[model samples]
Target: MRRPTHLRLLAACAAVAFACSAFAQQPPIERQMSPEQFKAAGLDKLTPGELVQLNAWLNRTVEEETAKAASEAKRKVVNENRGFITFGSNEPIVGRIAGEFRGFGKGRSYTLENGQVWEQVDEARLAGVRKSNPAVRITPSVMGNVWYLAVEGSNTHAKVRRTK
Candidate 1:
């Protein structure tokens, strides 16, 4: 009985080995050539029109990739530097504000002037004003111990108080 069992196990092992060998004898699935290989294989011998189309396609692909990378980098920068506002007493307010504001009031809190702190506002509400009134200027003014902001325009002269 022990011999018969051993022979059965040996036969099974031999069958498995034969099956594996038979499978290995077949050819593997062919892989597509890389872009370099394709070029080397005379793909570069395309017509002028085809070359133009290829160049345009390549340029568009590069542009899309570049734009995606730039967008991701900008997102990372914004995430790293969030909830903070940079203001200049003499600079234009419109330019001081970022193109698209995100991550505001998400990390830390801080104040701007004497008691004026940063607040989160919807982009849509601010977008129209920022676009239509692009020349608005914000400046810090001190009255005794109180601090105030002033808005100026192109046609308007300086020293005109717009805010208290």
Candidate 2:
């Protein structure tokens, strides 16, 4: 009788192990819930076909929402850093230079009021010029990463690179 009882215990343990493995292979919706919660939600009474359909709908919804969120995040980042980062937009970045503007010189950095910093990359100069808080327009090239920074009320345009 004791031997029969021990055999029954071993069989019950094996059955539990098999059930756990099967549960591990189920969808996230089913795997995430405890047995009590599944029964309480009446999901335990769902047929296998119903469970599959529910999991499929959940997966599609999650993927679509995730994609939308990722796209919105990317758009926000690009909009906020339009001056410093390029996102294939042809619109020129227009802003005022913070503090005094001593004109453009090679290797000089210009800090914009929007907190973007650009360095003059080419040998462009505007001699005998001084202004305070002058507006600037930084235009991108039509087919490349090259950008030109032009000061307001002047024809002088300097080739520039984002430094910060």
Candidate 3:
């Protein structure tokens, strides 16, 4: 009985080994060169050394083009974000008030000298009467589209949002 069991285990191990070796697939190449591609490029007739050179050039070209495409894509994202009127986190704006300042008591809107219109979103008000065309700054906080607006030198600020 023991001899028969040992023979069965050996047979199972041999079958597994045979299956693994016979069904093993080739590793994928970084760049594929199919038979049709080889024929199209007339690479099928190239000498071994010349074929090696062609593959090297193709790999380099693919790498450079991939890197260039990635860079352009990143630039496009940044430009698209910049074109919008919205302010991103950490970005700040400084400009003169377009008209006489009334004061933000219960959320008011004001047009800056630069033509940007902003509205206060909170109940924070100014202490003193802001004169005509006072320079103001609106800066984004740690996160979110929420911005804080105040006079150039005043500590008082209000949570505001862009209207136009």
Candidate 4:
């Protein structure tokens, strides 16, 4: 005799429950962020008084986002410079360095700490160290006819010609 459809459904649910329980015994993933970091990450763009409000909003957003059953909780921020851009994954203000050029040239590469490498072209070499042993932070600046790229985490800087 064939079993009832409801009984089959009940067995399937039990099997799923058992598998989930078994997986739950593993260690939880660890991730944490500090408030000082949040503030240092361009959060100062907003007024000091507005920080609390912003923090609350971020917290609620994170909570609501994390509770979604079918969502991937990954966040990234990207900033563009004259001919360069940097990317940060879940890290405030600290981003990965990247660049492209119209006339810099070929066969030029910048090497960072741990042997991470990037390429420079044309007049980019005049800007001093293209890449350093340690990855550098970059901020935007202008000086007369030259455009400056200031490294935040270090004292290194690069100057490139302004096409526009």
- The segments of candidate 1 whose C-alpha lies over 4 angstroms from its true place after superposition are 1-41, 85-164
lDDT of 2 by residue, 1-164 (tens): 33453455456556555654554454768887998898999999889999989998877776666556556655665655554545799989899999988888999999999988899999998988888999999999887778999999999999998766
Expressed as tens digits, the lDDT of each residue in 1-164 for candidate 3 is 33453465456556555544443432222235677875787767878888777767765665666556555654444332321223353557778888888677756887887566787889997756758888888877775557788886667888877665
* Candidate 3 residue spans exceeding 4 A from truth: 1-89
**lDDT of every model, 2 decimals:** 0.37, 0.79, 0.64, 0.38
- What does candidate 1 score in Cα RMSD to the true structure? 24.3
Q: Summarize candidate 4's per-residue lDDT along 46-157 as a digit string, tens digits.
A: 6756766766665665555444421221111112122222222222223344443222233445332322343432343333334433334323333222333334444534
What TM-score do all the candidates reach, one by one?
Answer: 0.29, 0.62, 0.47, 0.24
In terms of TM-score, how similar is model 2 to the real structure?
0.62
- Model 1, 129: alpha-carbon shift in Å? 42
lDDT of 3 at 52: 76
TM-score, cand. 1: 0.29
Candidate 2 structure lDDT: 0.79
- Model 4, stretches more than 4 Å misplaced? 1-107, 114-117, 126-135, 140-164
Q: Go through the candidates in order and give the clash count of each.
A: 0, 0, 0, 6
